[model samples]
Target: MINSVSIVPDFFQRVKTISFPEVIRVFYDEEPRRSKIHCPFHEEKTPSFHIYENGFFCFSCGEKGDSIDFIVKLYNLRPINAAKLIAERFGLPVSNGPLSRQDMLRLARAKAERLREKRLKEAFDNWARLAGQQVRILAEAIRLQLEEKGLDIEEDLLPLVHELPRLEWWANILAEGTGEEKLELFRNKDFRRWFTCKN
Candidate 1:
């Protein structure tokens, strides 16, 4: 089955990144670079077709093009359909279709924003996990030092000992707080200073 839709240059460029040598292995057990095959375009006994990362070429027939062109010629399909097929095969999601230049630009911007948000969320999640663990470790270390020194705690650690309750509160926020709560914690100068110093 083939999907019929016009493709933009951006879409074409994305699809072109698929390596021809790797794609050929889907059909042939032999690695394309290591083993040459008979020319698909011309009748040749000795293997003259060579697959490369960016493209392939048949020395016998002088047929040459990138991965997209390979699919286009192989299936006798239009460029857009070939691109859609290749993208689907590799699990790349393609939106239905583009209507106009302005529409395409809008779609591209929206896609970029979605990617940005996804990365931000991932980074924030990782930071929260690490922050929760780090605060607890620092508090435990301070508690051990407090035990060793009795009432006469080190001057450097006395501040942390004083702040232990707040650190516990911060740890709880890191573990289960809402995004706004986390944002406010980051905005607090004390929390920022302590987090940076401990890290």
Candidate 2:
């Protein structure tokens, strides 16, 4: 069996050394060092989320925690499971218990689930980044297409097309949308075509 007393302190020490904001950024986009982003814990038009060196606090929703707490909240995992994930991610050694067939299968399933979530998060990030870039490119293309057709478009509206609302919309979709919804988004033929094209 694992020695909890000896291993817990070492596990926490290693976890504490990891930068809290850096870990937040891996799962959500945040500006470096005290910049505000939309609170992942609550829905709002304005940003009330703040990340400090030691921890994070959401002003709107009153959510506050350190790195381990953040992982528990983000992943909806129990404390022990979160600890296991952190230990695995950081390559910290955990004292092994005797494995039965069921235990081995459960461990394998958990690892696979984590891997699937990682891949989905990566794909979501990639889609969001490309969508942001495409907004600018598509706007320019539309302006050109309109010009070619001799259509009059307002000058002020041109800048608005590439502004914060577009980005925020995409962020909301990624942050709040279900997995099936995200998959459906990527399945759009136009999006797939654009995603494959060279920039």
Candidate 3:
């Protein structure tokens, strides 16, 4: 479940304690004290962004915000992530609220799911690249056969021919500890027929 409040007040308070000018100095070449720098949010030839002791304001875009807001906008981070980044950078404590066992489990499950999805995507991409190479070889063979028969090769046939190996490869990769459904799909007679089709 999502947190009730994405931005924890304590975390924001800690982030606010860090000087905005100090954070700006990390990214900008010029000193931040009343100095003008190009607005990080928008493109401009002149430096219209001014840094104050408390926060920053861009004269060109009318963008004004505090330290946490600056980090969030500059890095394109979520409120919690930005707060955590600020805390980590400034050596401040991260947790603003107590975590229940359910929250811990939920976080763990979410992390595991993300990792699994990433691995599955990588596997699919790798199989796709190999399948594309195989399809090119098949297309060349088909072209040679058509030329021998004094016939024209159809462009649409390439995709139909390629689908079989791609689906088989995808199914095989997904079958590894995924479930019986993928294996069953791979073993279906229609799928097998498609895999073995010459035309």
Top lDDT model: 1
Per-residue accuracy of model 3 over 1-199 as CA lDDT, tens digit each: 5464664776687678877776675544553323667888899988899888788889999999987788889888887888787666554556656666765665567557656756875675454445434545654565565566543447665564456455545545443323334345446686556444221
- Candidate 2 lDDT over 134-183, as tens digits, reads 75565556556556654355666556444435434544554555545546
Better of 2 and 3 by lDDT: 2
RMSD of each: 15.5, 8.4, 14.8
CA lDDT, every prediction?
Answer: 0.72, 0.64, 0.63
Give me the candidate number with maximum TM-score: 1
For residues 1-199, could you state the per-residue lDDT of candidate 1 as single tens digits? 2343344576777777767764564434443324467767778777889877788888889999988788888788898888878766654556545356765665567557656766886787787778778888887788788889988887877878988888888989887776668768767898877776221
The 10-residue segment of model 2 with minimum total lDDT is 190-199
- lDDT assessment of candidate 3: 0.63
Model 2 TM-score, 2 decimals: 0.44
Q: Where does candidate 1 stray beyond 4 Å?
A: 1-98, 147-156, 197-199
Ten contiguous residues with the weakest lDDT in model 3 = 174-183
